[model samples]
Target: MLDDNLRASRQTAHDRPDLQISFEFFPPKTDVMEEKFWDTVHRLAPLKPRFVSVTYGAGGSTRERTLRMVRRIKAETGVDAAAHLTCVGASRAEVDDVVRGYREAGINRIVAVRGDPPEGVGKPFVPHPEGYRNAIELVEGIRRIGDFDISVSAYPERHPQSPDWNNEIDNLKRKIDAGATRALTQMFFSNSDYLRYLDRARAAGITAPIVPGIQPIHSFRQIASFAARCGTAIPGWLAERFDGLDNDPETHALVAAAVAAEQVTELVDEGVTEFHIYTHNRSPLALALGRILGRRHEVAAVDAA
Candidate 1:
């Protein structure tokens, strides 16, 4: 009965107008990776993600690579590009230069963040003192430099550094009040984590679309390591799903696709119309999920939007 009511609720929600979906990607670290990255780009471009983002790397380490990919997307792809800007290791002037470059390149969307400190996640964060203090500060600074559409990070399970969940919620409120138009959560595993986070967000009076971040898991070890750093809790059932497949790459791929497909389909069933995927530059997984979701993108539709 609840499933029926929930399904009916989604049908009603669908009538309310769907919010756009987008994805985030990291710049390739090698030549072979570069080829794979663009192949993924070409494959997903047809999906008409509202915008696709390139991740800003450690202490600005991936700055050049990320810039190269983002500019290329703006030049060659059918999708809008969002550049990630972070506050770790970069001063105001340094960040300003990057932001100005993106503007000149005709890219207008940004995912502003207080990036992980150069040391790494779980390490203490030392603000540049001169750089932005947090994501809110970064958003304000970006708004001042150029009229860019800025998005910030949201942690559905609470960020690693937050003293409390309310602190996390309050931080998000500050980001919104400071002008972030949307919030993309760090990648998560549980659908329930996302739904409950959204509910708490609304109750806290934060009205922006807190788009659930979906990471298509290709390797159990890698994803688990990532979830640990990012504060995403992997349920016991998920761990069980990947338990015995450590040595089987082919079966792992099949299982990975199935799990991601189920995640998104369930979210779609639960009334979540917008998605932001952390694609890690592997399009096959994201593509498999898209096809399962019935995405048959028409060029005419993309051009018209």
Candidate 2:
């Protein structure tokens, strides 16, 4: 089975070369982390991403910072910036204000999300009394404020709170009807799962581009924990790849790049041309994976050199 996967990866390595990629980033909370975040931005901006996004924190925790970062990215970088707008804690008016601010700052894109609960993942999400009720509503509200290229979230494995995939697809339809031009999926390891979800979405009349979210493993344990909370499944083979490299950063990074390269290569072979990379304020791994998927580097040759 492993050999078959490797053969497929090699076949893909020799074939597909065109890819349109975007990246996601979260706002930094400290001075040192801020420095690292800018370094990441500088390193990745050269790749010419479709657009780089800044994540809005749970319950609007990083609202100001998200805006500041998005504004700065648009002003300082050549890449287009997309701001994440959510209805977790802010009212409709507040969220609208943020949307207008993005327009004024020349940020013409947004990722509309319902966002996580204030208490954290797994906690019940109670919407603010005067806020938009959900992501679909937020999409509508953003539309009312300005003409922005809105992208809403999609869950390939079904959202944790959703009863089933059918219901999730219906919810996505509503978001599209509300004026979202694109749907970016939650992170999932299996390409087959994304393909199946895409089939279902198309069957349900969703014709917009559904970009798969690709998360390069910075720390297997950390990603596993997040996957557990967000209902993202980590395949056993993936876990096996990172099994005991927790303490060896060197080997860990090598394995991470390899795993991510294989994943993206297989996806590319399957005809997926667009990807969203979740860069957790780190660069080396995501940068490596980007170069690999674009066939800009030879993995073994880089390792050998």
Candidate 3:
């Protein structure tokens, strides 16, 4: 049922052992959600990701929860955890204090972002009168506080606010120049978009790793809605694949796995060796993706040996 080229690509990915992965999670708002969050974390921990990151909510609404979750994850799981820091609604001193908190907590890795305006994505981002103005300033502020391994956001398709590729790539360059060690792109459905963005970034002299962010289609409808909100284009073909399967959970799950499999394998074939998965606090699809990327549970492998 598979074409030879795609099948060979899958095999090549499985055989190559150099691939690296990371996961993103958000702070749980409720007790029930907290239980599910840990379940997801434990389920995917065996894959031994390079690091796991917890997101800070808009306007730092979940700041305390984000810090608590990241600390617990590192302390309990022994996995290096990164915290997301943003410049949306906090003054410079306040933001710097949070950075100090992360340093004190031993969270040395940070995902520095100019987060969505408190109003929401696509809304105008007005900096706090006394806060870091953008991601560049946020990265600089984080750098001043500690020697953090900072990561910033990139957009495969230009960000909604960026008027052109020049502006987009330049912004990325500035972020990296400030202190960011890596760039993690926004979730994109098209590999070509990512590849092209990479080429442009390279052309502009960005030498740091621009890791692709992979989003598993946990729910097609929900993901589509997110894509729309974030300005990510959904290909017609992708839409057609999920088209009449809204009520069929089983089939939808199968198709979701297949779609994500094809996407990552193709990237692997194109020489992409690093990935950052947005795990919306779920495990089945992320676990399936780990297997497809040739990662196995360390304990299971050791026991088998």
Clashes found in each candidate (C-alpha, N, C closer than 3 A): 0, 0, 0
Worst 10 residues of 1 by lDDT: 10-19
- State the lDDT of candidate 2 residue by residue for 1-305, as single tens digits: 56986777556433565678899999999999999999999888877788999999988889889989988887787789999988998889988888888888888999999998888887888989999989999998999988899999999999999998879999999999999999999999988999999999999999999999998999998999999999999999999989988999899988888888878877887888889999998989778767766624323435544
* lDDT (Cα, 0-100) at 124 in candidate 2: 89
Candidate 2 positional error at 5, Å = 16
Worst 10 residues of 2 by lDDT: 295-304
Where does candidate 3 stray beyond 4 Å? 1-11, 299-305
lDDT (Cα, tens digit) per residue for candidate 1, span 112-198: 988897778888888886787788888888888888988899988889889998898999999998888899988888888889989
Q: What is the TM-score of each candidate against the true structure?
A: 0.91, 0.91, 0.95
Comparing 2 and 3 by lDDT, which wins? 3
Q: Write the per-residue lDDT of candidate 3 for residues 1-305, one digit (tens) a residue.
A: 99998677657667888999999999999999999999999999888999999999999999999999999998888888999999889999999999999999889999999999888989999999999999999998888887999999999999999999899999999999998999999999999999999999999999999999999998999999989999999999999999999999999999999999989988998999999999999999999999999887766345654
Better of 2 and 3 by TM-score: 3
User: Best candidate, TM-score-wise?
Assistant: 3
Task: Score residue 146 of candidate 2 by CA lDDT.
Answer: 86
Each candidate: what lDDT? 0.84, 0.89, 0.93
**TM-score, prediction 1:** 0.91
Q: Report the poorest 10 consecutive residues by lDDT, candidate 3.
A: 296-305
